[model samples]
Target: MSPALRRHAPLVLVALLVLYPLLPFLDWAVTAIFGVRLQLDRQIINVMIFAILALALNLQVGYAGLLQLGIAAFFAIGAYTTGILTVDKYPFQLGFAGALLCAPVVAGLFGLLLGAPTIRLRGDYLAIVTLGFGEMTRVVILNLENITDGPRGLNPIPEPVLPDWLRDGLDRFLPADRIDLAAIHWIVLAALVGLLILMKNLERSRAGRALVALREDELVSGCMGIDPARTKLTAFAGGAAIAGLAGALYATNLRTTAEPNTYDFSYSIMVLCCLIIGGLGSLRGVVLGALVLLSFDNLVSPLLTRALQEQLGHDSTSVFANFANWRWLIFGGALILMMRFRPGGLWPARKREVDPATKADA
Candidate 1:
């Protein structure tokens, strides 16, 4: 690398690390330039949660080449686990920290339970089985009104409590209104950074290679003595654990948990879209995909809604102003165009080659 490139590499990485959480600060410039008031902080936090979810999905679809279509099930599992554990409800009152520790474990156990039976299946069958598992989970949550509160879900879940030292310092720096939001943002951002580092390390490990091999050719991998069943089950369980962690964070941040309806197929599809658009088997690609899709879903669509109302010269409630529903149509079309033009994704992973000299002569 050139001297300039080398010097700037660390800075670039640092900027990217900060970009997701700091996106809301950009609204200041937008407000100054375009006279638009935007809630960048809330949107960015939401995106961070989605980004973590995408990372988990990437582990399944990207690394293992598993077409898991029911990730939202794991997400819901985590959310409800956190809610039930942390909320001071009729029968439980575990702390947020305890919920954080236990939720992923429960979720991973569920993943193992689900994967054990289905990992032997391949392709579409595996996908269908997993999807059915996810839907079945939702139905159970929906019907368990006595415990889960059913469609009403759980409420008054406690906000994640911060250490006194940190809380005191934050209170000194920020006004009351900004303190809670800023704390949550920083905490979530920290969790995301931690997950990124962990996943990146996993991608470089021997186990990761086994996953890649399984993705490339399960039969050949099995012939080489790798247990495809064990590897796939591990990936499924690990990915589900990550999803569960994300769900816990989300519930604690929102201080509430919705019914199964809130975590339906649409959310699962969105997470899958993030992995597909980002690039299979690449962490950087997954993050990029999440940001792009989330930016469209949360930021661009809202702006377009306002723009359409202005162009129609009518109130937003008018039939001509029904631009919100069109957002998904446009998004779906864009996905098709992206797949058609760049099937490998915008930032596809570069294939690494094994040195010929290192290979045994056949």
Candidate 2:
């Protein structure tokens, strides 16, 4: 590595570590500065959760080159699993810890089930099949009113238990009642950082190379004794597990799980959009994408909606009152512009090579 890069690496790592712990504090600072009493920490947590989701998607799309259109299915599975398990559901009272563990497992199992039959397919067909599967899962969740509560969703979801020492410390800072959201935020953030580190390591490992090779050319990978089907299945399962975990975290954070309608095709597409716009095959890119996209979705959209209503002197119930209808149009236009100018993405990953000859020459 270059001396400059090596010198700066530790500083970067330290900055990130400090920033993570102080994220809530920073949000509070911003709110205080603006005289706003918004739940800034909650918003930040939401974006971080989505970033984890995008990273999970990146594992399949960026690393493995899988065009998975039904990622929301796994996300829904995870969230619903957490909801059912942690909530006071009839005949079951698995605690938050169990729900946290089982959410990913159940989602992974579903991913395995979905991939087993379809991993043999490739390209557009695979995308279509996955899209259909995602839609099907949502439909099932919506229609299964008896189990899922359909459109009404599940409420009063239990909070995940924290270690006594940490919980007590947090209680000192925040009210005991409102500490759960903050706790969940930290938990999700830790999980995201861990997953990112793991994925980065995997990207530098032999398995990651095989995945990239398979992505580049299945025939060559097959010749090299890599089973395309198995590799793809593993990628799919891993990606699904990540999304599932995001879902579970999200449900816990929100303290509810809405109907299947919540995890619709648009949610999947928005995540895919983040991956593409942030930069394919790059973790940094996906994180950037998630932050930008979700920020717009949650913050900018509402602002725009209020602005439009005020400008037009229309009531809240005006036909153009909702900003969601125009969200796709704006997102689509941004995608088109990005594709036209920088198809690789906002932060395309550059290949690193260490040449011994160059080192000797230097």
The estimated TM-scores of all candidates read: 0.90, 0.88
TM-score of 2: 0.88
Most lDDT-accurate candidate:
2
What would you estimate as the lDDT of candidate 1?
0.82
Model 2 local distance difference test score: 0.84
What is the C-alpha lDDT profile of model 2 across 1-362, one tens digit per residue? 89998878745853564355434576668777755455666777788889889988888888889899999999999999988887777557687788889999999999999889988886889899999999999999998999999898887788777788878877776666556665676688788788888988999898898999999999999999998898989999999999999999888888898667989898999999998899988887888898889778777777677678777774778656779677888788877987799877998887777698998898
Report the error of model 1 at residue 361, Å: 6.3
What is the per-residue lDDT of model 1 for residues 1-362, given as tens digits with 9 covering 90 to 100?
A: 99999878745865664554334456677667755666767767787888898988888888898899899999999999998887667566887788888889999999999999888897789899888888888999999988788998887777765678867876765556566676677778888889988987887899988999999999999999999999999999999999999998888777888767988877888888887788877777888888898788666777787788788774767754766677667667767976788867878987888678776563
Candidate 1, clashing residue pairs?
none
Model 2 segments more than 4 A misplaced: 1-29, 32-37, 314-323, 354-362
